[model samples]
Target chain A: MCELLGMSANVPTDICFSLTGLVQRGGKTGPHKDGWGIGFYEGKGLRIFHDPEPGIESKIAAFVRKLPIKSEIVISHIRKANRGKVELKNTHPFVREFWGSYWTFAHNGQFKKIKTEPLGDFRPVGTTDSEYAFCWLLGKLKKKFKESPQPESKLFETLEILMTELHQKGVSNILLSDSKHLYTFCSTKLSWITRKSPFGKATLLDADLSIDFRKVTTPGDRVTVIATNPLTSNEEWNLYKPGQFQVWKKGQIVFSNE
Target chain B: MCELLGMSANVPTDICFSLTGLVQRGGKTGPHKDGWGIGFYEGKGLRIFHDPEPGIESKIAAFVRKLPIKSEIVISHIRKANRGKVELKNTHPFVREFWGSYWTFAHNGQFKKIKTEPLGDFRPVGTTDSEYAFCWLLGKLKKKFKESPQPESKLFETLEILMTELHQKGVSNILLSDSKHLYTFCSTKLSWITRKSPFGKATLLDADLSIDFRKVTTPGDRVTVIATNPLTSNEEWNLYKPGQFQVWKKGQIVFSNE
Candidate 1:
């Protein structure tokens, strides 16, 4: 198993606050210490930083904690070796390009016999079950949609079906994004919190830091954060039931499998 | 124009010393300050750090300089943004996965009508002639070789021919690597230097720093550094002629168009 942290916002936002709490679990407060990675998307530009080191000890993760790289979408993960060797290739937050957009995926649960499926054009560079599932999912999507930039609703429906297929095999808790939208599927554990104009103060569960969201954000700002577990103790985190899937855009939940 | 930096080594070597010099060119020493990026290949795992911010001032670049992530192949670029906007996607070096290996490319020159070429299976995530040319090149190779993991010699020959096609159109000075081989092609300015057993001291032209290679390296180590210009003032660098293509593996030149 691994840990995942994701963010979506109406305005460009940084994940330093959320990341600080989650990275603690990477080797400090928790046991996931194999490796970690994160990706930030600015429009069509996707910037990724991967380190085959524990996130708590990684200098790059420390840099990320200090620097406020504002982005509309972000995904991060801290992994514990299970089905794959602990290496840079097996680091979480895997990416593949399709339909002229870079798609990012990070998973958090063990799966059984997922590699038995055939992959199309996209192949996994890493020998991880997480990467294998991503390639398989993307290949299925690409095969169905001969032309890309597909209608959002159509794409979302197809994605849910694909997620269900993976769910049939084993735990498939995942956070994925295609620059424009973020899709999160929960097999067992996933939680989220959305902050809007009337945002108040919040404190990190693992760290001693606290922030008053109102001080930094405007009245029109909206932000949503998702993770395998609640990162903050104060916020009202909405937990997902098993086999739940949700899609987000512009900081709002557009669709879901209720 | 932009500044390109690349390395090939018989052993896993860090490019920190050379990167310290090249990054200075991002703003302090040169005018190519739009953006910068670097990719390091460790086996099949590629770790990349991209910043639309100038490398000289980027905290990420600063972190990269201090942390030594050793690798056998590296490609770094500081861009001036001639053909595309100063953004993350347009920042070199651009990467795409093909033949189950991560391919990295960095360009130092511009092209006129490179975008007019048709892209197959791969598309540019950014609006840049360099990315356009890379997709075009890789797509052609993929078409010819239906199966991946193609013979090294065959792939090298096909790549040389594809590079010639780009050279015919306009400036296509590029540094490309597919984990196993580093392919360099020059349409204008490009140079290289190889250091081996009897390594000597070298001084950077852009910074007031020097390294005595004999103190840090063993006689069994061999390293090849390539750049748009001579990065060090004290070292003897070999300049490539226009339309020349060379392939390097394990820090040794395997083939050339000489």
Candidate 2:
């Protein structure tokens, strides 16, 4: 019982608008109030802000909502603490380095028996099934391919297979990134929306705020946002069926298993 | 060259007072204006703030300086780029995970050819000699000890040997932590100060700031601050000799190579 938010953009973009709505679910409009974390990728460097406090009351989250830190890829999570104790170490959107790239992952559902899975080089610092699952996924990737596999399709295929295994364990809706692409596997609930040319005004579902994309974005700007639930009431969001796997690059879906 | 700052405390303590003076050196008092970063350890979790902008003017740095986020261990850096371009990826205070602990590293000197060193599992996300050296060191440790080594002294000795090799290459002042101990290696310059029961007032060297440690601390609290150069003007500081390696725990020096 958590919430996830992710973004991929053709240009560096901020998630303040989406994040403003998501933070409401952290405490105000919903019950996911244990802790919150967000990761923003600025080139190859990743900056993460983690607060054990409820996101609705987090000073850091307020600062982040106001300060527009632009990034090509972003991952964020608000926790309800189903598998681990509420602490800074158990905050979601966990990160690790593999093959010279920073990989970030956020999960929105539970896995019953992920802890029994063995880990290799990557180990979880916290006692969360979500983190254990991330380490397990990354360790499998590292073991199967000594280096980043060439002809990216091979890597995508491997990810699909691994994600399928995780889905079999339990509800495992995931949003992951390898600095270059955003990979998503939905076990239960997920939705996404892409804004490109002719972008119009949208109102937040949780708050009384509206933004006209035409005023802020250029025609060339393309941005994709994925979340466990729709953040905007006006915008149309595409729902993913269960067991769907997708790879997104530059705000567009490059591969998908329907 | 860059500037480094670190802290180890017997109790959870804030480094805002020390960081206030150090950030001034990022552009106002010294030449390290390329970027800045700091990591604060909260139990087993770590929170880091990195800015490619100069610390003197960075909004993030200003917010961090005002927030009294207490931590038991801290590592920070202000960079003056030499080998790498001025970008977020090349900012100081790099991080990696090993043996279920997050290891953070910040370097204050140069390595002439450290990039040529071979690596095993750990890899650098940025193109910096300091990060290369960290990768090489951690990779060697992972290779030698399958798990965390028993008998902590053995790990310290192994670190000393690895750091000596780094010192041979060039100037390699380092501050590293694995959520437990603060490991320091000095090639040319480093200093430390410990404050306990008899707290006194101190004045900053780079900023118009003064703090009375008596007003903020209790008698049982012991705190150690390490930096490339002493941060305060009035406090007496202990200087590390060239090629010195030390391990610190709970504000006390556990082992040192004098």
Candidate 3:
């Protein structure tokens, strides 16, 4: 029903190349044209741009595309509204602050009756089932751990259990980040690719553009990008299995429920 | 010290003219050049743009100045960075969600030893005293009222008491909003002007730009602009006294401690 694009990197990086490909799907290459939003995490601070306009047609999106605002974590979404009306409030990705860190979430699929779930301290400002689900998940997390859980693996395990419940509701492909890591849960479609020292030229599947990663990146730079669909035609994107959950840190997959 | 600019209007209005003047203070006209941020409220949705660069030189700031994004409520800040480092996380115009509404805050003055205060559910993502004060204030409010206070006046009264506590800590000139209303607390410098029917031309004090409000607005339109200093040279702005608080709705002063 929508598209999600996310990036996690060992160093501050820009998603302009990948974003250019994905935004094409927002209107020109695909039908998801209701609205779009993106969040870029710079250190502990997160800057988000939200527009209730077709990503391909938005001036803000154009500015974002042209300007390379570097960040270690980024999440973006292009919407085809189903549960919520096409409005600025309903646009993804949504954000909430937790444990003194900003957590950003974007959904790519639908959920049945997700709004009926109870929320804790976190509340949804928008009417989307996606936002309601995020609020429910984060509220539950906050209730479980008064602060960020020690032994980070425990947090991952709890997220797996909570996300599985959401998977049972319906298609629940999600991209979420908490400044330090990118967490992904897939119920249906999801794919990711990691580019490192041996980076080569890659052509976009949706747009008439190509980038030679070798020219722009250093040998030590590692960058991982996740999306609902593969953005590059030549890159070897790892497709996620249904009901899988993965956690990425510093451009590498540190945990996965394969 | 920093600069604050806020607007409350009966209808959706763009702050391009005022922003053009205020941004000059971010570097060219004044010394507040550490960072800048602005939040524009569209219904229940909020769109924010943040730049760590001086507002006068920031490309993002330039784009924002040119874009006519209409909003009914707006909160903006240009920082001089006293309590925190000149980083994205330390930039002002902090936000938190309470009772399903997004509360945006922008401060113009420093709060000495404010971060020493205890907090509840809300936490500060950045090490700025201003953000810490916001978290403490909101956490206290959330603790007092599990939901938004039933009687709106009670919330206003409670805010006055809480803000008075902040005033005790140090200078705490703040412009805050919760979608429906703009709540301002002044410990030092703050000023406001309401433009209604029979509007006239207004010229910027910091810049050479001038706007004829009569040509752009209808008689039914009412807009209130709040700033750390009066943005226009020709208009009469009412200055706030120390320890003064005011609540604005539909561009009119609904509550005030004159």
**How do all models score by TM-score?**
0.98, 0.99, 0.99
**Per-residue alpha-carbon lDDT of candidate 2 for residues B67-122, written as tens digits (9 for 90 to 100):** 89999999999999998898898887999989999999999888887877789889
lDDT of 2 by residue, A129-190 (tens): 99999999999998999999999999999999999999999999999998999999999999
- The lDDT values for all models are 0.91, 0.94, 0.93
How far in Å is the alpha carbon of B252 misplaced in model 1? Answer: 0.5
Candidate number of the best DockQ: 3
Model 1 chain B: worst 10 consecutive residues (lDDT sum): B146-155
lDDT string for model 1 (A30-107, tens) is 888999999999999998988888989988888888889999999999998898998898897988888889999999
DockQ of each: 0.86, 0.88, 0.90
Once fitted onto the true fold, the runs of candidate 1 whose alpha carbons sit more than 4 angstroms away are: none
Top-lDDT candidate index: 2
What lDDT is reached at residue B120 by model 1?
83
lDDT of 3 at A73: 94
First chain TM-score in every candidate? 0.98, 0.99, 0.99
Docking class for model 1 is high
